[model samples]
Target: MGILALQGAFIEHTKMLHRLGVDSFEIRQKKDLLLPMDGIILPGGESTTMFKLLNDLDMTTTIKELIQNGLPTFGTCAGMLLLAKTVDNYHSDFLGTMNIAVKKNAYGRQLGSFRTTGTFASTQNVPFVFIRAPHVTEYGDTVEVLSIVNDKIVAVREHNQLATAFHPELTTDTSIHQYFIDMCQQ
Candidate 1:
C-alpha cells in the first residue's frame, strides 16, 4: 500500500494500516510512484496545498494514471475532494477519477468538526471522525453509498475507488482499513 505523504494526516493512516498487518510507505516525490503498490490512501488534509505540491513535484499525472487504470484507492476527507469529479466552489488538476460530486467541506469548518457512530453500509455502527469533512452530495450511477450520517453521505465506493468524508484512522476502528485491504486483495 502507498500513502500520499505530501501533507495531511498520513501518519495516522500509516499506523492504522500497520495495525492491520499491512505494509505501507509514503509517496512524497514523483520517484516514489515507481514503487509497486497494490493500493493508495489519500488522507485528510488541506486539498489546495496537496494539489499544489503534487503539481510542483510533477506527480499528479502518474498517480492519476495509476488510479484511472484500476488501482484501488481509498480517499479520506481532502483525499475525497481530490478523487472527486467535481468539488463545488473548487477546481484543481488532482485525481478526478471518482464519478462523484463533492461539496467542499460540506460539514462546515474545523470548528464544526465532530464525531459520531454511524452506519457505513454493511459495516454497521462504525466509528466516524468528521474533521471538516466533505460528504458526497451526489454520485453517478455506478457509485455506491457505503455510509451516511444525518442523511449526509459519508462514504462511497465507485468501482475500484473508495472514498470517505470522515477520518477512520483517527479512531480505534480497524474495519474500514480492513475493507480497503480487502479491496486491494481483490
Candidate 2:
C-alpha cells in the first residue's frame, strides 16, 4: 500500500500502518503512485495546497482514474474533503469521486478544534481529533455510514473507498488502519 505524503500527519499514518503490519510507502510525487496495487491512503493536510500540488504534478487525473478503477482508498480530514463531490466555501475542483457533499471546517476553526470519543467499527470510544474537519451533509446510495457525531456523518465507506473526518492517526489506536488493510485484502 501507498500513503499520500504531501502534508499533514503523514509520518504518524506511516507509523500506524507499520504497526498494523502493512508494508506501506510514502507517495510524494506522481511517479511514486503505482497501479494494480491494493490500497492508498490520502493523509490529512491543507486541502487547497494539496490540490494545487497534485495538479502541478499532474497527479489529479491519475488519482481519479485509480479510484474509478476500483482501487481501495482511505482519506482522512482534508483527504476526506478532497474525495467529496462537493465542498462548501471551496471551489468545485476536488477529486469528486466519493459522491458525498462536505462542509469544510464544519467544526468552525482552529480554536474550535476538539477531541471526542465514539464507537468505530471494532473500536469503542475511539479518540477522534477534529482539526478544521469536514462533515458529510449527504452521501449517495452506495455510501455506507460508519460513524457520526452530533448527528453529522463523520466516517463513510463506498466500495473501495473509505473516509473519515477525524484524524485516527493522531490517536494510538490501530483498529481503523487495520480495518482498511482488511478491506484491501478482500
Candidate 3:
C-alpha cells in the first residue's frame, strides 16, 4: 500500500497500517509513484495544499491515471475532498474521479469539530473523528452510501474508490482501514 505523505495526518495512517501488519510506504515525491502499490491512502490534511503539491511535484496526472485505472484507493477527510468530483462552490476538481459532490467544512470550521460513534458499513460503534470535515451532498447512482451522520453523508464507496469525511486514522478502530484492506485484497 502507498500512502500520500505530501501533507496531513499521514503518520497516523502509517502507524495504523503497521498495527494491522500491513506493509505500507509513503509517496513523498514523483519517483515514489513508480513503486508498485496494491492500494493508495490519501490521508487527512489541507486539501488545497495537497492538491497544489501534487501538481508542483508533477505527480497529479500519474496518480490520477493510477486511480482511474482501477487502483484501490481510500481517502479520508481532506483526502475525501481531493477525490470528490465537485466540492460545492469550489472550482476545479482534484482527482475528480469519484462522482460525488461535497461541502467542504460542512460541519463548520475547526471550532465545530467533534467526535461521535456511528454505523459504518457493516460495522457498528465505529469511532469517527471529524475535523473540519466535508459531507456528501450528491453522488452518482454507482456510488454506495456507507454511512451517514445526522442525515448527512459521511462515507461512500464507488468501485475501486472509498471515501470518508471523517478521520478514521485518528481513532483506535480499524474497521474502516480493514475494509479498505479487504478491498485491496480483492
Candidate 4:
C-alpha cells in the first residue's frame, strides 16, 4: 500500500497500517507512486495545499490515472475532499475521481470539532471524530453510503474508492483500516 505523505496526518496513517500488519510506503514523489501497490490512502490535510503540491510534483495526473485503472483509495477528511467530484466554494482543481459533492468545513470551524458513535456497514457504535470535516451532499449511482450523521452522508464507497468525512486514524479503532486492507486483498 502507498500513503500520500505530502502533508497532514500521514504518520498516523502509517502507524495504523503497521498495526494492521500491512506493509505501506510513504508517497513523496510522482515516481514513488508508479509501483505495484494494492491500495493507497490520502491522509487528512489541507486540500488546497496538498493539491498544489501534487500538481507541483506532477503526481496529480498519475494519481487520476491509477484511480481510473482500479486502484483502491481511502481518503479521510481533506483527503475526502480531494476525491470528491466537486467542492463547494473551492477551486475546481481537484482529483475529482469520486462522484460526490463535498461541502468543505460543513460542520463549522475547527473549534466545532465533535465526536459521535455511528454504525458503518456491520460495525455499530463506531466512534468518529470530525474536525473541520466535509459533508457529502450528493453521490453518483455507483457510490454507496457506508455511514451517515444527522441525515448527511459522512462515509461512502464508490467502486474501489472509500472516503470518510471523519478521521478514523485519529481514533484507536482499527476496523475501518482493516476493512480497507480487506479491500486491498480483493
Candidate 4 residues lying further than 4 Å off, grouped into runs, are none
lDDT values, one for every candidate: 0.91, 0.89, 0.95, 0.93
- Give per-residue CA lDDT, model 1, range 1-186, as digits (tens): 999999999999999999989999999999998899999999999999999999999998999999989999999999999999988767655678999988887777889999899887697879999998887878999999999899888899999999999999999999999999999999
TM-score of each: 0.97, 0.96, 0.99, 0.98
Judging by TM-score, tell me the better candidate of 1 and 2: 1
Ranking of all candidate structures by their TM-score, best first? 3, 4, 1, 2
lDDT of 3 by residue, 1-186 (tens): 999999999999999999899999999999999999999999999999999999999999999999999999999999999999999968876889899999999998899999999999989999999999999999999999999999999999999999999999999899999999999999
As a TM-score, model 2 comes out at: 0.96
Q: What is the C-alpha RMSD of each candidate to the true structure, in Å?
A: 0.9, 1.2, 0.6, 0.8
Range of the 10 consecutive residues with the lowest summed lDDT in candidate 4 = 85-94
Check candidate 4 and list the clashing pairs: none
lDDT of 4 by residue, 18-51 (tens): 9988999999998899877999999998999999
Q: How does model 1 fare in lDDT?
A: 0.91
- Candidate that beats the other on lDDT, 2 or 3, i.e. the better one: 3
Q: Can you list the residue pairs that collide in candidate 2? A: none
